[model samples]
Target: MTKKAQTPAVQNGNTDPNTLQLHKDPAQTDAAQIAAMALGSVAANAMTARTFAKGTFGTLDVTECVMTLKQRVDTTHDGNLKHAETTLTAQAAALDAIFNEMARRAALNMGEYLEATERYMRLALKAQGQCRATLETLAGIKNPPVIFAKQANIAHGPQQVNNDSFPSSTRIRAHARKRGTTPDELLEGPQHGSTNMDDRAATTPTRGHPAVETLEPIHWPRKPRRKSGGGA
Candidate 1:
């Protein structure tokens, strides 16, 4: 005969100890499942909260480092700008001083130039006066014979001449004809002749004049002349 089949021991129609029976009371099973699920959810939430806190702390550290670096950079930029401004101000002052000195020198030079011009003008006036006096003296001495003739004419014509009357060429010619001479021959005297000394002096060349110096020749050393026998 076959051995009799062993019957499995069952608790509420489930043989596994870990699994609840399907035939168990529904309300009690639901309550137990809900309690287990609530505990699992609470653990999951605690783990998620810890992870979020760690990520937030890391982000805060990064933000703090960025803010610190930005602050340092701002401080350095401000300091550089201040230094540049100071240097610019100093340069402006130095340029102003230089310009003022240039202006002062210009004014001094202008004053000296004006003083020299004034002195030159005074000397020129003095020389001009002396030249005029010398010309007047020469004229007086050289015109003595003409003065005597004019005086003789005035004395002879004292009754006929008015204050504004000038001797006409016809009257001068008649007087020269009565004297048995031509008008030109009577007028021509040694000192008061038609030959002007000023004109003669102007037309005559000066003696013992210095020769003009020629320009120096420009040539490189040891170079052959282009034209050997001609003046440059």
Candidate 2:
């Protein structure tokens, strides 16, 4: 039996930049959202003595409470980092490929030049949007500063995305003396070599960044347009 070769997707005279669509990977986004939910759950459970009350009879342990924060930061920070890196890196690669393809097309016939240039513009805009999204996702990891903040929780801000239900560092410290620990030791960010969630870059607060941009746009080789002439 003879097998036929697949036909090329593009046919002549059907050049349309808008027809090309960007394929986004939902896996990264899905992972990030699920991680967020899990992180949130962990934080909510760690905020109180309810879980510990069963064993300690309502005794508040500062180290124990701080451990909860550590766990929360670790999970959230790590997940956010994974999502950010995967998402941004993928977007950058996609944009780069698109630009190259568009550039190749622009160097061909007249119609293709226009179509490819338009697509190139659209790609730039898409890249910018992705960059902003990347920034937002990274911020969701924890405090944006934590990604690059000074060591020892120097950049550990009091704010959190889903940690409203958790106790404040001040309260945790106030109750620490009762448990033979200091607040600084507890709230000073995740302990090094402690949890798998310790990513120095992910813990820092930072704006979301895009993986692609105008750099991906290819310069079109201008083609000459024929002038109208009257028949003699």
Candidate 3:
């Protein structure tokens, strides 16, 4: 009798320890993949945070880096608004100083050096414009601009269309009726004795000229012609 084939030692329903283990539960495998992805994401975010914080003086660990990455400017926060206001104030002050210096140079060179005065005044004007722009920016930051966009309503239902052959005819008739006149007469417009200036000039007499005068053709005098002959 052949001896019964002996099976290798099985652990957790696996035939061999060296063989790759097949995950029976899809959920477990997915969970492991998700965990790895999460770890990689955290590392990436931490690296980005490190790069962002590189020039800063303070030292930050992974936790601090993650926290910093999570932080964002809160528009509704008072502290953020105050910080922005302070920064704008500082910039405005710096611009004001530049403007004052340029103005002083311009005034100093006014009578003595025309070119220098012009150049300095031009620079001062530029600085003044920048300061004004900065102040305007600060004001905008304090109270943000509100834009009003007019919303147009579209009609989706059945629309009433006017299919009148002559759109103005009805209005003309109604207006003529209100004036107690026929539409044809109203359309003929105001009655005039003469239609145009030429007719009026022909029909009416001028200050010195009589009306209905006939103009005759002008006759120029003919020059006398000599008989052709050989000259002696």
Candidate 4:
């Protein structure tokens, strides 16, 4: 008796052999897989530490070298980031060179002698785009986006935000409490007469900027209208 040929697994009732089939490699055993993963992890960690050391050698401070292991880990992180930035910049330079060469070739091919103008031109365009994208990526990697939870509020109305680390009001209040005085007095500087807390509390000092002095609204005088004469 002859063994029948087995067909590849079909998907959605289709007989296409090109369809992808997901399965573990038959040659890779459980132990082999685990060992490979462990080896990869070890290699990655070694590379990271090596890169960190290379980056930190010239710039490493005595305090950073002698401090807690956690600080060393943090320095390692900075070193790694610096390495990444350096790598990205070098890659961008390489890409720029590649793009320039490709562009030159494309320009050369566009003439009467070269037959592969379209192909070279297309490749050059692609290279230029890739170069631009890589530089953009490098820029982003160098200066990552900063998320500001609170920003300076320059607009009008009650909605205001403080961007300072320590607010002036808080500092003033703290000093006032320490010196046995009101926040208003601290703000006004050395004054002979003390201001009433009731008056200060009654007036809201421009919500966001507490240090800014509030000015009274200017009242403009209106001009009188001339009376019209009938049939002049």
Candidate 5:
């Protein structure tokens, strides 16, 4: 007997071969069904492969772009930091130079001040020496005898003698005689006579002479006062 052709299921006006009925002898139709199933699986595998490839490529591109931007930003930030460091270093150096210069100037000024002070001290010492010398010279000139004799003559005019200048011991003897006292008694007391030779000469000559002797005390000049403040 001859068999009729089998029809497949229909959906949306199309027949689906996958849903077609098979004969009772399934082994004879197994090869054809397996081939169709393999073709459908290949189509699905290709679609999956395309999707994975597109996603992987897009992810890789985005990652590369982000890395590049990060690298640029990091480089820019590093450059800014380096510039700031350089500027700070320069400013520090400038400040150091300024301080060093100030110290140097201060040292120079100190040196000058010390030198001026030393010069002033030297001048003052020189002036003091000159003053002392002048005073000593004046003291030597002012004969103490002349002053004593002049004072004595003024007090006791014609009655005083004008003997040769005597030593202090002789003058004390004469003074003791005039006072009607012993030389030893006069010498022993606190009222001692002048020991200076000039004083002895002046007083002794006036005891019994008519000679008018003039005596002047030596006058030492005073040191001149400086008008400027401090010697320098």
Candidate 6:
């Protein structure tokens, strides 16, 4: 009989229990990979939360800046409108003084000039009255008021946006009709108008935004009356 060939107890890539030869179990390796993937998912969730929180803070910061700008505009317009009224009051008083002067001296030429000036003052007062009315309307708008906004969310909340917290051109118009004065003229700012006396025109004083109509100046002739007897 031929002798049977002996086979090795351990195959290649197999571990021997008594030696350092190592082998991996497929199921156990797969389980370890799954656990690693779960840990990575946890890290990714943490990163995502951080990113969202960062953007939320940025939005809050921007909202704060917008509110600050609105405050400045509010203060500026408040002071501006009040100052305009006061200045107009002074001008009206000055015109009255001129009328008193005209009454004291009886010259037809001076009377005519004074009448023209008074007409300009009346137009100014009318414009001022409109401004006052509009300002009252504007001031009536509540600031930071609780307003409802439609949104898809977990629960209903007050609107976060400030729709009219600051003045736009429309708001600055104070709801006054544009019929009397152009919106620009109604809101004549500190930056408007000429200081030079030479530039003064015999017309209704109008200083405003650049868009305001440039009215043609009326040349109210302060022409001298003719002499009873003689020559030119």
Q: Among these predicted structures, which one has the highest lDDT?
A: 3
Which is better, 1 or 2, measured by TM-score?
2
Q: Report the lDDT tens digits of candidate 5 across residue range 1-232.
A: 8753234222233243223232345665787765663465433453344345554442122223333444545665675344434444555555455545544544555656876555555554554455455445444444323443343444445464455674566677778889978655423333555555234345534556677988898899998986987676
Error of model 3, residue 138, in angstroms: 1.4
Count clashing residue pairs per candidate: 0, 17, 0, 0, 12, 0
| Candidate number achieving the greatest TM-score relative to the actual structure | 3
Every model's Cα RMSD, please?
Answer: 48.1, 38.5, 18.2, 20.6, 47.9, 39.6
Residue 96's lDDT within candidate 6 is 53
When 2 and 6 are scored with TM-score, the better candidate is 2
> Compared to the true structure, candidate 3 yields what TM-score?
0.35
lDDT of 3 by residue, 89-194 (tens): 8888888888889889989998999899999888888888888888898899888889999655456897643445547666777787898877545233345444
Score candidate 4 by lDDT: 0.58
Q: TM-score for all predictions?
A: 0.16, 0.22, 0.35, 0.34, 0.16, 0.16
How close to the true structure is residue 224 of candidate 4, measured as C-alpha lDDT? 91
Give Cα distance to truth, residue 11, candidate 1, Å.
Answer: 99
lDDT of 5: 0.49
lDDT of 1 by residue, 42-61 (tens): 33353444345553442122
Query: Model 6, residue 126: displacement in angstroms?
Result: 16
Indicate the worst ten consecutive residues by lDDT in candidate 6: 14-23
- For residues 30-102, write the lDDT of model 2, one tens digit per residue: 5675565446654346545434453444333333444555665686676646644566667766755665665
Name the better of 3 and 5 by lDDT: 3
TM-score, cand. 6 vs. native: 0.16
Instruction: For candidate 3, give the lDDT.
Output: 0.63
The full ranking of all candidates by lDDT, starting with the best, is: 3, 4, 2, 1, 5, 6
lDDT of 4 by residue, 37-137 (tens): 44654334544443466444432222222233334347667765665566667877777777777778778867774667676766767777877887788
